[model samples]
Target: MQITFWGAARTVTGSCFLLEHEGHKFLVDCGMFQGNKALKQRNYSDFPFNPAEIDFVLLTHAHIDHSGLLPKLCKHGFKGNIWATEGTVDLCSVMLPDSAHIQESEVEQKNRRLLRAGQPTIEPIYTMEDAAKTLTLFKGIKYHQLVKPAENIEVVFYDAGHILGSSVIQIKYTEAGHEQIVVFSGDLGRYEHYILHDPDNIEKADYLVMESTYGIRFHEEEKSKEDLAKIINDTFKRGGNVIIPAFAVDRCQDIIMHLNSLVEAGLMKQGSIYVDSPLSVKATDIFCDHPEYFDEDTKALAEKYGTCPLKTKNIIFSETTEDSIALNKVKSGAIIISASGMADAGRIKHHLRHNLWRPESTVLFVGYQAEGTLGRRLVNGEKIVRIHGEEIDVKAQIVALDGYSAHGDQTEMLKWLSNIKEKPQNIFLVHGEESAMGQFAEIISQKTGIATLIPEMGESYKLNDLAHFVEKQKLAIDESGDMMELYLDINQQISQMMRAKEWQKLFDIKEFLHKIS
Candidate 1:
């Protein structure tokens, strides 16, 4: 029995893990690679393991970095059930298809460019039909439900609180008449954050596989609301618009909720908050449908302010291209939220192109901006940028609000691990950059006195203890002792025959050698 770290071992994207026991193999989170060209190129690489041989997939959430490659897995002959929470399934129902659309659209545009450059056309990683087919294999499991997916493997999903239906998967596997538990913390969320439940505490685990996305930093979560309100009010006072390039799923909705809170508190000035992505529109509907997952504060607020506390009177959803284009015509007092969060693609690019040249506009980043992305470039104070083949001046105010990060920071994560009643024998860290992983490993080891491993991409480790292999070797040695006498007799007979130069007894010598050789 072993586990392999396929992705998210050294970098903070493409979270995939493969576990094998006896002959059965399963995967947890087959995700797409995102970041620089080198990282994004990994999405096109062949999977190390055979898709057909995989028994099932245990999805952690609906984040594209965690579940985006399901369509590609299905396209490559994976015909297994995909287990997830109800909310995750519903969210993926929209997100996966949207991801496929992006893949096709991007590939088509690339092919056009390739044609002009006299290069070969390339196929998309997957298609809309492929994503549809992948959806058919989904099986939803409620939070805290225990399930036996295989002969020797049992699993339970607990709320991770990072996003809707995200989970910390605890798996119990029986080997050598002994049972051991492995907990995979898919992605942890902020404690007592708006709209979602706190991450559930896991009492015990023999081995823990945790994410370390925010290992080296602390988020400004405590003062996020104050910071947001101040940024909006300041921008409004400057006669500028506040533009937020956010992830459509959680980040966009998070900003929406904050905007609603600001409006209710009368902290933000008069401005129209526009969620300008169709994906965000669909995701918001999904969020509205799953109020059961909301925290007490959110539920009470909803009751006090109608069905959804996320939608304020000034909030507007621009789900159509026409509506998105119309937003460019507005010069000020408009807070436009769009995706992709990294500003590497999507309608957010157009918004940036239009507003970035304006001195009165303010761009607020609410999530992590990876290196080599437009968002990072803007945050790093690039004076000029080219969007859609046109150079544009970067005169807008660029700001990053760290409080909106979904991943819990170092302090919160340490507190989360301290919740385990008994320390795990070994803690394997993944889903973070190398430097962060190193720092986190040291902290975990120093605090808990438990050994921590930072696995590299494509590294595999045996789950069976050293004693088991040692015992097996001893048994094999004892059994081999029975052959020692026969070998001695055969060696003596062969030596005597050879000394006598017994050519006529060659068959007898050969028979003796064959008996024990």
Candidate 2:
């Protein structure tokens, strides 16, 4: 048995992992690379392994970073079933097509500039047809139900409490006449979250693959209803709009619930609230359909309101491009929530472009801003920024309330790990930056006295050979002169050249290498 870290190693996005047992190969996430251009460019690269060779994909959730690349996988010849929770399946039904639309739209916009310059146009990573086809292959499984995706493999999903229907996947399989169990913590959520249930507990596993997104940080104390009211009331008094960049799925709904409470309590005056992303509007409706997934507090709020917790008298669902554009005309007393929580893509950018230069306007960020993302730039206090080719000054009030983050904090993550009665033989950390991974690895070692490994991108590990495992070595390369080693070296160099945009030098190197060969 072997496992490969294909993505989400030393980074926060693109969460794919490959597991092989008994001649069967399957994936854990198959997510897309997000944030910086170098990472996003990976979306256009070929799969490290042939997608058609993959037996199945065990999806953890419907978050774009976790499931955005499914259509791309399908477009690249993957034709296997994708097993996920029923809620995840339903969310993907809307989210995948929305992601495809964004891809197409971004490519189209880029092509227009290329056309004017007489340059070659580029295609989207995947089209809506590919997304539609990918959806047809979904096989919904209920939480906690054990199912077999391949021979000698049994899989079960536990509530991760991150986003709606997110899961911690457990896999039990036998290899070389011995049984082994692997548990993957797929973005564990905070305890006592507003809408979702707490993360489920597990007691045993031979090996564990965990996420450390917040390993070195702790979230701020939860704000009271009054705090939200204060921000809104203050912004309104300044004759400015509160533009919030929230995720379309859960965060948007959570913010709406808070706003509804504030209004009902008379803490803030009733005002117009525009949901600018069409995807967010659709996701809000989906959130309404899954009342069973809500916690007692959220359910009670819904009952008290006698309607969906996300709905209010003053709320407006902006479903059309014109309607979204019209929102930029509003000067004050409007709470505008848009998708792409990071504010890197979607209508959020348009709203920011128009409002960011106004001193009275407020831009509230309610999610994690990845390194090198536009959201991070604004959050980090960049004085000036360019949006849609227009340079804009950063004059608006920027605030980040990380209490609204879906991912749990460092203490919460440690508590989740400490719950397992028997510590695993090895804990492999992924889905985090280098600094966080290093810090968390040390903390886990000191607290649990268990060994931990921080795998790098494209790193592989042989699970059956415990004693021979060498951390940070390329997989299956036993000698310095091996063909596989040379191939990996060449691939690494080519990737570096591509990232550096050294097209001519890259071609010359390739030609020289071919001649030498």
Alpha-carbon RMSD of each model? 17.9, 7.0
| TM-score (all chains, Cα) for each model | 0.89, 0.90
Candidate 1: residue pairs that collide: none
Clashing residue pairs for model 2: none
Q: Write the per-residue lDDT of candidate 2 for residues 1-517, one digit (tens) a residue.
A: 6888988998989999988777899999989889876677777767878899999999999998899999999999999999999889999999999899999998887667556655566778899999999999999988899999887899999999998889999999887788788999999999998788999998787888999999999999868888888988889999999999999998998888778778878998777888989889988888888887788998997898798787767689999999998888999999999978888888999999989999898999998899988899999999899888678999999999989888999999999998987678889999898877998999999999888998887778888635125344342312221222234446766897999999999889989989999
Off by over 4 Å in 2: 465-517
Best by TM-score: 2
Q: Pick the candidate with the highest lDDT.
A: 2
For 410-452, candidate 1 gives per-residue lDDT tens digits of 9888988999887688888998978778988998899889889
Clashes of 1: 0
